[model samples]
Target: KIPEPAVAVDAVSITPCGEGFPQCDFEDSAHPFCDWVQTSKDGGHWVLGHKNVSIHGMGPS
Candidate 1:
């Protein structure tokens, strides 16, 4: 499992991408943005990768 952190961010674009990984499990399906954030915040498993984004107003812009 990846190490969980305080928070995570999906600083990437959600628009049509050329290629990507297939949604595997629950986390992959739900968190189309960033899973590490909620996962870590929820006290679940830790995520290794970190997205550079502001935790404040992490909602749809």
Candidate 2:
């Protein structure tokens, strides 16, 4: 199964930052919900581009 919507979006946006974005030492004033990030891409037709696993209702703490 695919992951949650957020994770996929985060993964795609964050992966280019070195696969450890948010968790890494990269500086960012955005991405407050970086803790709940999970990303996976399904080349198959079952899912959309990248699928993510993450929580909702989270923001900068």
Candidate 3:
């Protein structure tokens, strides 16, 4: 199954993670709930596109 919802109707917006996106550094803001995080013998990280939502009381948090 696809892990996350593919589309959101009331999207707040899509923002680029910016110039050093996905590049690890000491100062990068931690994405504790990143959708594409994976773990195995060889660790991995991926940047999945995010659709911010502005609706209230719609889905479980």
Segments in model 1 whose C-alpha atoms lie over 4 Å from true places = 1-33, 39-50
Query: How does model 1 score by TM-score?
Result: 0.16
Ranking by lDDT: 1, 3, 2
Span of ten consecutive residues with least summed lDDT in model 2: 42-51
Give the per-residue lDDT digits (tens) of candidate 2, residues 1-61: 9976663334433336444333433345554333444334623222112135433433233
When superposed on Cα atoms, how far off is each prediction in RMSD?
Answer: 15.7, 16.3, 13.4
- Model 3: which ten-residue window has the lowest total lDDT? 52-61
Off by over 4 Å in 2: 1-51
Off by over 4 Å in 3: 1-8, 23-37, 41-61
Q: What is the per-residue lDDT of model 1 for residues 1-61, given as tens digits with 9 covering 90 to 100? A: 9977777775867676232322335455556544434443543433323355334433332
State the lDDT of candidate 3 residue by residue for 1-61, as single tens digits. 8797597688588788574244443353565443333336533433333354232322222
For model 3 the TM-score comes to 0.19
lDDT of each candidate versus the true structure? 0.43, 0.37, 0.42
Deviation of model 3 at 60, angstroms: 23
Best by TM-score: 3
Q: How far is candidate 2 from the true structure (C-alpha RMSD, Å)?
A: 16.3
Q: Work out the TM-score per prediction.
A: 0.16, 0.18, 0.19
Order candidates by TM-score, high to low: 3, 2, 1
